[model samples]
Structures are given as structure tokens and as C-alpha cells.
Target chain A: MSDRIFGGIGLVIAIFFAWQATLIQTSFISDAVGPKTFPILLAVLLGISSVYFLLKPDPEPDWPRAGRFAEIAFAALVLLAYGQLLPEIGFVIATALTAGYLAWRLGSKPLEAVIVGVGTSLGIFVIFKLLLGLSLAEGPLGF
Target chain B: MELLASLGDGFAIAISWQNLLYALLGCLLGTIMGALPGLGPSNGVAILIPLAFTLGLDATGALILLTSVYYGAMYGGRISSILLNIPGDEPAMMTCLDGYPMARKGQAGEALALSGIASFVGAFLSTCGLVLLAPQLVKVALLFGPAEYFALFALAFATLGGISAKNQAKSLFAAALGIMLAMIGVDTQTGVPRFTFGEVHLYDGIDFLVAIVGLFALSEVFIFLEHRGTEKDATTGPRMEIGRITPTWPMIQSCIPTMGRTSILGFISGVLPGAGASLGSFVSYSMEKKLVDRDGTFGTGDPRGVAAPETGNNAAAGGALVPMLALGVPGSGTTAVLLAVLLALNITPGPLLFQQNPDVVWGLIAALFIGNFMLLALNIPMVGLFTRVLMVPPRILMPIVAMISFVGIYGISGSSFDLMVMLIFGVAGWALRKLEVPLVPIILGTLLGNEMEVNFRRAVTIADGDYSVLISSPLTIVLWAIAIIGFIIPIFVSSTLRRKMKKDERDLTD
Candidate 1:
């Protein structure tokens, strides 16, 4: 997005936050500036800065091309999916799958990627769970 | 003197076999981390906080290890900058101007050696400064009340804004957004949720580590992915000859003066809340170029050119520790991560830290002294080995980094929700970086937001609701003046400088 559009969006978010700040209910007011004061101050500062950005945007906004957007989106999806699957499928399996996929995407041979994936996954599991004694999510195939 | 006595005690703790070993491990890990492209001291420390906790080291041991890593990374950053022409971190960016030229000229080994020595000298001397200056600074810090703290934070913000990317407004906005994020969770004073939106997990607020790891490490991975195929044609430079790893005595002698000057300059810059290692290295390099490199050989493999930035950056690393040690404020992002570690350990840093936790404070200082020496020894001999890390392909390295971030955060919080938060912030951080919004101020704002609010409220309460109390104190007045000037001068100076440069170009054309 262009700086002007991003700034406009930021301004809207800041306005929403400012309104939310007004709704914060404080039970006991010990100080002159209660809980809402700082948030309001921050929201106002953000709103003003957004307006400044809208007034003068960068001439050449260095946005990534559409070609590279797919890669970035894929990586983000992989991470989000990894987070979701970490507890459900457990550490080793989730890590292996995600790491393998990412490595392969980045140009590692499929076999090398698989080795790296399983190795890193098990390696970290051993280090954190066994050596450091931290509890990690255990998969169906324990250890 | 009490300083001497405390330092003596510090040595006793630091010299213990366990602490010494931890320091060594930290230095080794820190150097490896620093040598890796796109992973600097801040990311190194942030990614390893959980590991430190998992090891169950006492506060002093954990601090010694982590701080040793911090210093070690400063030393190791020059390795990649000199060898691969890819700076391992921002502070090492200056090193690339000269170090890369030296490498292309087959003086890579000598460049690496000089930077190692320079880093040692810079870190060692600045640590000595820390030993001497921190106690006195802490005494001054003890005198600061809520009003003073508020002003001090303002000064920090203003200075950060000044040093941030050319757009001061954007930097301020990012900082404000960070503060807004910090407002999530239940308010300590009012027992009301400000922005939690009724989520039970939001009661304690967002974890700063999660934010840091996502913003720095994960965001870095996304960028790495964006440029992955583009760098396939890039070549690793000539292998460093081991025999040339040791600088000639005269070459070392020439850099001594430059190192001395830059170390002092770097230390002072590091002590400032906003100006960290990058500024120190930049200022030192520019100053050295103007002062000594009159023949115009600065960017073309000059040893002194390599020395100035290497020394300045490492010295600045030591200097950056002062605020976090003396005042509960972090002077840089890396130190902010360190502060987070301390907070996680249930240790509050400030004037009281010295009296309340002398072992943690003093032991860390003494460990820094040892860590610098260890880094010099490790970096000079292992320069070749460290450079080999550049050969590690991003495909393998980046996924491991991601795993470390995932496992490390999970180890600490043991919550899947935080992992999701990290992933979300990682994408947000990448977008923000693309937009040129500086991340340091955001981290600083989040770290200091609660304290800033608490101090502001406390000052107001003490003044019986008189808002003027914030500006009443002499110290606060001076800080406010500095803050205001800091904001105005940078914009004014840069514009004039740009105008002059343009006019000069036009004149040359004529």
C-alpha cells in the first residue's frame, strides 16, 4: 500500500482507539490522570502523525512486487499453520513438516531438506527436553 | 573506595569456575550468533532468554552468560563485515565501508585481526569506564523522582526520534503505537482493563520477548525469504589466510590512537538512551575519516578505517549497559532485551539494583571484563572458523532460526497463544520495516510504557493533581530543554545539510 493509504488506515485505527480509551472504566481514581489518559495521549499522537504522513507521502514507496508477495504470504501461512499445529500434532512432527517445507521452498534439495527438517526438529527436542529438562509437547511417537 | 571493594567482590563471583564457564559459553555462542548474517546481539539475546531460564542458572550466572554473549556478539559482528562484506549487524555496517575493501584486496585476515584487537580495546576500556562511572551514575539516579523520570523518558523519546530514520513523525508514531500496545491488560492503579478486550490471556499484557523475537528474528526471516533466490549468484570471497591473521606491530600501533579516540566517543554515545552502537560507529568512522584520512584512502582498505568503527561499536556495547544497570532504563534494543530478561528473573534494575542485588550487578561487570578478553582470544584465532559460518545456506539456517524462536518462546510462556501473537507480529514487523518505521523506538516504548505511566501518575498524585509538577524540577527542566532541542535540531540540521549538498552539486555542474 502507498504511504497515504497506510496513513489513512492508521488514522482510522487511532480514532477507534481514542474512542475506546474514552470507554475505559476506572473504579478508583488515585491520580489526576487516570488509566485512560496515557492511551488518549498516545492515540492523539498517532492520529497527528498519521495526518502528517497523509499530507506528505514518500514519492517512491518501496513496496514489494506482486511476484515476491506469494513467497512472503506462503512463509507467513507456514508459520501460522505451524503455530496452530504445534500443540495438536506436537513439536517434533510440526517442526519437521514446516522446516522441511520452508527449506525446500528456499532451494534445498528435497532429500536434504527432509534431513535438515528431521534433524533440526529432533535436535532441538533433545536439547530442550532432555538436556535442559524443559517440557515440550510430545508427539504420538515419543522421543 | 566502595567501587574498588564492590569490584573486588564482583571479581570473586565472576572468577568462580561455574560463572567463568558460563561466560565462556556465552561468548562462544554470542560470537557464532553475531557472525551469522541478520542475527545480531539483540536477536541473539532475545532468542536465548528461554534457554538461559531452562538451564536454571541463578540470576548472576544467567546474566553473566547472556551479557557475555552480548559483548561477544559485538566482537564477532566485525568478522562477517570484514570477510563476507555483509555486516552481521547494524553496528558492523560501518566496518563494511573499509573492511570489505580490505577483503577484496586479500587483506581479509589482517582486517579481521585489526577489528578483533580494536573490539577488545574498545570493549575493555569502555568496561573500565562502566566500572568507574556506573556507581556514580547510580547515585545520581537515586535522586530522581517520578517527575524526573517522566522527563528523562521524554528526553529518551526525543533523542530516539532525532536519531531515527529521516521521518521523525513516523518514528514518534511507531513509539506511540508501542505505548498503546503496552496499555493492554489490567491497569495496576485502577483495576480496570484498558485494551484487553476481555481476553483472559491479555490480563498480564503482551510479552515483550514475544514482540522482540517476532519483530527482529522472524521479520528478518521473512525478508530473507524475499531475497532468497536473488543471492544464489553471490560468491563467498577468498579464503582468509591463517598466517596473516596476526596484524603487524606497526599496523596495531597505528590504530591505537584511533581506537582510543573512538572508544571514548562510542562509550559516551552508548551511555545516551537513544544513541546506540550504530550511531557510535557511524560518528567515529566519519570523525576518523575527517581527522586522519586526509589522503582519501579511508574507504579503500585502510586499517585505521576498520579500527575506528570496530572499536567504537564494541565500546558502545559496553556503554549501552550503563543505563540499564544504573537507571532501570535500557539504552538500546539489545539492552532492552537484557532488561526484559532481568524483569523475567524477578530482578528490577535501577539505583536499588546495586544495593539490592550487588552480585548480579557487580558479577555482570566483572564478567564483561572477562568476556572481552575471551572474545579477543576467540575471535582472533577462530576468525577463519567464524567466517565459514557465512557458507551456511539460508535454507537450512533460517528454518532453524524459526524453530529457535518458536521453541524458545514456547519454553518461556508454554502457551500456544503467544506463538500466534509472535507470528502475527512477525508479519506486522516486516510490513512496518518496509514502511521505514524504525523498530527500536517501538521496542523502547513498549518496554518503558508502563514505567512512564506509573511515574507520570505518581508525580501527579504527589503534586495533589497539579500537572505543573512534571515541569517544576530543575533536572526536569534541563531534560525538557534537551528533549525539545533534540527534536528540533536534527530536522533543521539535516535539511540545511541536504540543501548545501544540492547547491554544491549544482555549482559543480555549472
Candidate 2:
């Protein structure tokens, strides 16, 4: 089930943390408790919790089926690309693309999604960047 | 007399056109967001923080605006519960019990109006409670040493699971994960980098605000995607025609005592670390049922049933500010976001906040009272308009939520790196939520992790590394005992109180 998988991941991270804790080079003038102690303590807590999940896995979590999961993955991909594309495409275009695609994915008509996208992009740009004068990426538009 | 003077000063500040305008705006937007299904106070505040900051308000103005949103959202959450049978958040779940039933009986308008009044009663009373109680709590808190502070932080993490958390292990695991995340960046004391992985951005540690927006707001988008159009989307927001907006005078008279009693009860629950509004709502609804449901009419669209939870949760929401303001600990997850904003502003919360920034503190308090009256006036006439939020389906609404998170994070930091981390947290947050791990503790851990580490070192140094110093004082011992009990007892107790709270989770997931 998903519980054991999560536990396995948690335990690995906990061990990684504990190992990293030991690797921390404490300066000579550091206080009685250095950086390693709290992290090590936290690592142990994480390890114990992960073991609980491993030994006492709950019922199988109701994960979505293939198509829905693919949709989620795609949206996540869009968001991932969004972060990368922001500085390049600027906030307006990047936002429009992400917003439009998401709206379309959310069951909007193509034109409506595009409107939502462009509207969201420009709306935020005008309000935040223009009206409020907060900093946003100018990209090519230089607005 | 001193309290009155300070509160009067607060009123003087809160009444300014700019602050008043901000308060009005916050209440309006808060109600709109609160009525949206799947959005709660945490998401509401997180999504809108950029806007608050973008407006170029001072700390006092910003706090007033956001805290007004906080109160308004508590008022708005009932809209979905009554009209759509979907709660905006956990605290609103109790409202759905008797609320939707009343709506089905064609009393949706009455239900909305009644809950609004109840919310007003709860919020107004609790804001009064907060003004009277918080300074006293601050006096006691000033006695805290580093050890007691450490114990207090531990207590916060231990109890943050609240009544809705199904597993303590999951909460602990999440907290540790957060602490590990906090362990990234350079160690300030030793000048050693802990887990920088050779990235310059890692030197400042993962910003909690970025993490918050991602985990709460962005993950919400991903969750919407997974359930987008399948029968997994069965929990559709079905709107009821909100007929007959006002409750009869007799009905109001009947419920007056219930509101009065539950206000105090909810405030006490809110003041308790980790209990928050959900516990407040649950306790109030159940307690009222016990005392007055002799005919078993409590859940069958009883006016009192609708009134109890609304008031309790609202009161508890107001009450939750006590710890955050007095002890530098959050009373609920929503307050945690507020606390993070405070810290980001370099305004330390706790006893010193009262001493150093009395204007800000008192202004915020005065604004909460002002917000309470504004919400009552707003929710009554505008309940019909607020109900319109339920009509906006996930597809259109969700993208807006996503855009806000994207734009907000970007606009605030202008750092794509922060946005990138936000996406990771969003995706990872979706997975954790699906696994039933609570998100609040993870946030709390990150928010308090550095301070927890600092207090740990301070305590150790003060006691010359005896380590026994943690339990040396009575306050420390009491806090440690509470932490242990909070972490361990719920697993064995498994009371009906917890089971009923779980039922909401099942209904939600179903």
C-alpha cells in the first residue's frame, strides 16, 4: 500500500538527515550543543514515525485512476514549466499560457480558456505591476 | 482603565480612512473566498497576502486587513455548508450537519441569517475575551525561560494534529520533514552550512511563506485536477434557493442563550494550542446537542443546531489569536500564516510585541471588533451574493486560485527559485495530503524550527549541557507532560468526539 511506500521514503530521508547531521563540522568555539544535535533528534523522530507507518500500514489510499492521475501529472508539468518559463516569457505570457491551459483542462471552451488566461495575465499585470507597482518580470513587453 | 485606554488608542488608529477601507475590503473578499468550496482561512490568507503586501500598507494596516479577512472568512464558510452541503473548511463541517438539512427544508435563508448572527455573537464576544485575556497571558509568558520556551514549542507541534488528524505518526513524520527542511542553509551559530547542497539560495533556508503558499494554495489546484471530471467529482456544489432570509423573533430568542454559552466555550478551545476552531465547532455542536436535544431535533434542522457550531467556530477563530499574540505560538494553522507574515515583516510576536508595537497590537484588536460588526452587516444583506461563490465551479475558479499563487509568489519575491520550490511543495503536498498526513504541523515545524533550535541551545547553555534542564521547572514539566499526552493519548482514547470529526473526513474523501 501507499503507507509502506511513504514510510520507506521517510526512513531513507531520516537516515540521510542523520548522516548529514554527523557530517556537520562543528567549529571549535561553537556552544555546548552544536547544529548536529537538533537535526539528529529530528531524524530519530522521523525514523520512528516512518517505522510506525511501515509496521502498521493503513488501508490502501484511494489514489486516482490512470487518466485522472495523468491529468494531475500534466498540470504539475505545466506548473513546473511555469517556474522555468517565467523569467524567459515574462509574467504576462507565462501566466496566460499556464492559466489558459489550466482553464481549458478544467473544462472551459478553448476561446474561454484563452480569455481566462489572457485576462488573468493582463489583469494581474495591470493591477500588480502597473497600478500597484509591484515588480514582475518584464520579458519582451517591458511593462 | 489601562485596557480601555489602550483599546481606545486602537480604535483611534483603526478608524482611519485607510485602515477602515482595508478592513471593509478584507471582509468582502474574505467572505467571497470563504464561500468557495475547498478554500479555508489558511488558503484565503495565503492567497491574498501578496495583495495585502502589494497595497503598500504599514504593518498595522496590513494586519487589520488580513485579520478582518480572517473574521469574514469564518462568517463566509457557512455559506457553502448551508447552501451546497460542502464545507469550505473543517470548522464549517459542523454547520453542514444541521445546516444543509435546514436548507433542504427550504429554510436556507433563515439558516444563513441565523448563522450570521451567531457568528457575530461569537466573534464579538471572543474579541472582547481576547482583549481582556491576552495581556494577562503575556504577563505569565514573560516568566518563560529558554527551557520553557522550548517546551512550549514542543507542545505546539505535539497538539497541532487537532481532532481531525487520524494518525499521530503521520503528523510527527510531517513535522520532522519540516524540521529537516529547516535544517537546510547555513548554521548561524557555528557558521557551518548544514544541507546547502552547494546552492547559494540554500544559505537562507527554505522560506516558510513560499512553502505555505505552495502547500496550502497550490496543492489545492492539483487536488482539483485529480478529481476534475470523474465521478470522483461527485461532491458537486448544488445550490439551494435561499428563500426567507430572516429568522423569526421567537427563533432568535430561543437561541440567544446557546450563543452566549458557546462563545465562552469556543474561546477557551481557541486559546488552547492546537485545538483551534474545528475543536471549537465540534465541542459546541455536541455540547448543545447534549443539553437541549431532548426531542432528538438537534441534527434535524434545529435552529439551535445551526447556531451552536457557527458561533463556536467563529469565537474559536477569534480566540486562536491569544497564543499567537501572547506567546509567539499560533492557535491554529490560519494564525500560523499570520505569524509567518509577522516574522517576515521583522515584527516579533509575543510579550515584546505588546511592549514595542502597542499601536499595531491594539489597532489589530480594535479592527477585529470593527470587523465583527462589519461582517454581521455584510453577511446579512449580502448572503445571497456570497452564495454566488458556490456557483463558480472548480475549473474556472481553480485556475484563478492557481494564477493568484503563481502571480502572488512571483510578485512578492520576483524569485523564480522560490516559485520552483513552491511547485515542488505543491506536488509533494498533494501526495502527502492524499496519504492523510496533516499539513499544519509541517508548517508549524518550519515556522518554529529555527527558534526551537535556538531555544534548545539556549536552554542547554544555561544549564551547562545537563539536558535535564528541559524538565527542571514546573511550567516546563507541565508543558512536556501535555506534549506527551497530546502525542500519545488520542491513539488509545479514540473517543466519539474524534470519531465524529473523522466522519467529515470520510464524507469529504467519499
Candidate 3:
């Protein structure tokens, strides 16, 4: 049942890629098969293989447990927020929140997470910007 | 003779204070990351890739540090596997088999020390192999043409299939999909945009980092969410002492044969694309099982099993660099990250690297030596300290890891678009994993996609529409033969093993 869903998705994605490859510009290099050829070949290969696997996969292997999925979702969302805020909130503040959140998830005490998160952000700032002489943009928080 | 000169030049590059500092930093960071159970060398290297980009050092120096981290993590991973029973990565998985057993027997100190020594031996021996074999391999590589390159890629795909035996077809499909995705940017040939969907950022093509982080790290989050754990013992065995950091000379001597054999095996296997350190460790462990027990005393806390896999994995780490350094091809996903760095630096890695960039080459070689020594120093005394990382609750640690992944990826482009792609890739990657597909091949396929495309185009261009250019060159024919034969052999070997396994199962049932 799962296989059919994935196979269908794979087939659609393959078609999308095939159609896209056909539109790419191919002039920098010399006389050749051009850019479209490889992607089209890949699409065909994927379409066929997806069908094959959907028909016959190995004996079921254990998938990751439920908590793992939650953790992944939480991380992805937090990371998405981190990227959105870094430029506006500044590296130090954004990073601190990000770090603290991660530390919390990883098992640090609440206070410890905040401290470590803030400390890590400052430390990175000092090392990269001050010591290494790389310039990082200061966000709205101004630190 | 020629090799000696190169070694001398490499020494000159490595001995400098700046490069030495970079190597030490890389080693220290790598050890810390490796000691963490869930974070392996690949993530360590991947997470810090943006830093390398932001810092923008000379190609050689950047590569030296990155490669050093890779090498150090290979050694440092043993620390966790031995003390905590958590393998840092797939290669270290074998170490847990006997290492944890030895640790449970109150030999944590001995296990840690032995594994460390085994790692040093494996890495050093593989370096020797690289020094001896690289130039010769380069010369042989010079004979390759477009068709040969394609054939080499085929062999890589085949090996990936073999390694992922349970779902070879699915793995290939994923790989092919990755290759197609790589084709989304503007075509260099006719100036046409392929799959951009009108987004300007997509024109630069998919950044390898975005794909990798999504596939490996982000998906890891989802997987982790599914499997929450209960509390365990707070304390472990007697704390490791400084005196127990080094293996006894006699103990070292006893395992020399296993170490030596695994090093060679690991190095040889590592040179072939798609056959990463995981396979190297497995092959080595099996070989040790055969040699250590004429009558079978293996896997019952025998030090040979631990030593064999540890040595094999470390050596394979070093061996894997050969293709990366000499041929510009990565033997595994981690090295492909390095390849991306090289590309970003406008450094083309191929036969051209040695001829055009001597300093980078030598500096990297030198960094490897320093990096290994530093790893040993850092890991030996700190085994007890690092083992404590396991005590931390996954709840807190998971959040911080997520944050790092978020900040690191965002720090790169400062664009929400990249983050969005990351999310999509994460979900896709998770779905693929659920279907029993291997992730390495997808990354590998993406890394090799453009190369294959260009070469195929070039081959045809050279032939001027002639269909026989693929077989016209002797080198191409030879490579094609090797690819075909190499692929068939694995299938034949695996079928025999499968039959033997089934028969053994039936015997047990009766």
C-alpha cells in the first residue's frame, strides 16, 4: 500500500523532471546530446525503478519509532524559524534561541539550555567575527 | 623517487603554524562531534561546511582542515561505541559488537585503548598505501576518456546496489531521482532553464548541502521523533584512567596481523566508489572471524573482532581520500561534501589538480598526519569525559541539534527559499528511508550527475554523432568491461551467501 503511493509520487516527479529538462538552455558546451538528455534518462530510470520497487520490496525493515518523527518535525520547524529570524533578530539572539531549543530537546535543564545556547552564540560570534575576522550581520537585537 | 619529492613538498606545506593550527582545530572538533552518539563525522563536516565557505581560505588549506576532521572522526567514533554502546556512524556499528561486551566485562579501559591504537595503525597504514599508490593511480587515470568515466560511474552505481542488497532497485530509483533533480538548473549547453519553475535561486541549481542536510540530518529528526527512549543507568564502568590510554606492546603485537590485514582490505575497498567504510568494516570483521578462530572463538568479547573492525573503518576513511584527492571523484557521500567545497572554490579536481595545485595537495597530505596524531592525543585521555555525553537526555539534546541544523543551513544563504527546499527534501528523504532505500546513493548520484552528463555530451561531441565513440577508445572498452564484470560478480556472490543463510535458518528450525 505504501509502495503504491510512493511509486505514484515517483512517477509524477519523474515526469516533472523530464519536462523541466527539456526546457534548460544548452549552449556553453559544444556539439553533444545537450542538458535534456541526462534528466530524461534519469526520469525514465526512476519511473521504471519506482515501479519495480513498488511491485517487490524486501521484507519489511523496522522504521523509526513515533517519538523520532515528532523530534524530526519539531527540529525542522524550529530550523525553519531560525532561518527566518537570523537576519532580522541578529545572529546572536536567533542563534541563542535556536541553541537553547536544541539543548532543551537534547536533555539539558531549562536554565542550562538557555545559558549554553546564549553562550554558544556569543562564542561563535567572537570566534568567527572577532578572532577570525569574518563579518556577520548584526540583526535587530543589535548584539 | 617522484613520490618522495611530493612527500617532501607536502611536509613543507603541513609544517607551517597556520596549517598546523587548522589541523589541530579540525581534530579537536571532530573528536567532540564523533564522541556524540548521533552526530558522526559526516554531520560534523556537513554542519561546518558553511563556516568553511564563510571563512573562504585557500582551497588546499580548507580541504586540509575538512579532510582532517573526517579522518579524526573516524578514530574518535570508537570512543562512544566502546563506552556507551552507541555507534557514532555505520562504520562504528561493528565496534559496538565486541567493544560494548568488553566494556561490560569491566575492560572499558582496555577496549578504549585497544580501539584507539587500532585506529592509529589503520590510518597510518592507509596513508602509506595512499603515498605509494596515488601517483600510479593518477598515471593510470590519465588514460581514461569520456566513456571510461561513464563506466566508472556505472561501477559506482553497481557497488551501491550491491551494498544495499535488500532494496537495490529502490536505491537505484532514488539515485536516479537525485540525478534528475540535479538537472533542474539552467542548462550550460543551450542557455535554457529546466525545472526552475520561475524561481531565480533555482538557476544556481540545487546546493548539495541543502539536499544532504535534508536527507541525512532533517530526516534524522523525524526518525528520532518516532522513537523516544526510557531512562537508563546514570553511571558506567570504572572511569578510564590515563595509564590505560595506550595499548600494551604485547597486546598491540597480538592484533598486528588483524590490523594489517584489515587496513589493506579497507584501503582497497575504499578506493572503489559506492563501497564506503561500512562495507570495509563488515568485510574485515568477517575476515577476522575466519582467521582468529580456527575453531571459532569470535564475537564472544574477543578483542580481535573489535580491533579488526576499528582498524578497517579508520583505514577506509584514509583510503577513501584517494579518489577524492587524486581523481576529484568521491568514494562516499562525506567526501562528496568536500567535492562541493572544491567546486565552490573554483578548484577543479581531476588529473589537473596535481599539475596545477601542488601546495593544496602537499598541505592536505601533511594535515592528515598531524590530524591523526592529534586525534589520538585528544581521544585517549578524554574517553571518560566523552562517554558522559550519553547521560544527557535525548529530549534536550534533540532540540539543540535541531537548532544547529537550522542555524547552520540558514547562515549559508540567509534565504527562506533554501529552508523551504530543506523541508521538502526532509519529508521526501524520510519517505524514501521508510521504503528501505539507501540515502548515500542519492547523494552520490547527485554529486556525480553533472559529471556523467557532461562526459556523455563530450563523448558524443568528439565522435561527431558517431555512435561507436563509447567503445572506440581502448581505455573506455577496458573500463566498461571492468564495470560490467565487477557488477556481475557481486550479484553472484550475494546469491550464494543468501542460499547459505537460508539453509542455516532451515537447519535451526529442524
DockQ, each predicted model: 0.76, 0.80, 0.53
Query: A59-136, model 1: which lDDT tens digit per residue?
Result: 655566787788899889988888887778888999999988888877789999999899899899888888778877
Question: Taking the tens digit of each residue's C-alpha lDDT, what string does model 1 give over B1-510?
Answer: 888899999899899888889999999999988888778998898888877886677888888899888887878788788777677887897898888778878788899988899999999999999998889898899899999999988787777744533778887788898888888889989888878888888999998778888998899888877776674323335555434788899999999899999999999999986678888888898799889997878888899999999999888888988887898877677787888788868898899999988988888888988898888888888888887787787788888999988988887777889999999889999988888887877887877899899999999988888999999989999989988887777666756644543453243223
Please provide, for model 2 over B9-110, each residue's C-alpha lDDT reduced to its tens digit, 9 standing for 90 to 100. Answer: 999999989889989999998898888877888899988777677556788888888888887888888888888777888889889888988999999999
For every model in order, the fraction of real contacts preserved is 0.79, 0.86, 0.68
On DockQ, the stronger of 2 and 3 is 2
**In candidate 1, which residue pairs get closer than 3 Å at backbone N, Cα or C atoms, i.e. clash?**
none
Better of 1 and 2 by lDDT: 2
- What DockQ would you assign to candidate 1? 0.76
Off by over 4 Å in 3: A23-30, A59-75, A98-123, A126-130, A133-137, B161-164, B230-243, B294-296, B390-393, B485-510
Interface RMSD of each: 1.4, 1.3, 3.3
Against the unseen true structure, what C-alpha lDDT does each candidate score?
Answer: 0.84, 0.87, 0.73
Clashing pairs in 2: none
Q: RMSD for all candidates, in order, please.
A: 3.0, 2.1, 3.8
Off by over 4 Å in 1: A28-30, B161-164, B231-243, B495-510
**Candidate 2: stretches off by over 4 Å:** B232-237, B501-510
Worst ten in a row by lDDT for model 3 chain A: A56-65
Q: What is the TM-score of chain A in candidate 2?
A: 0.96
* Best prediction by TM-score: 2
| Local error of candidate 3 at residue B148 (angstroms) | 1.9
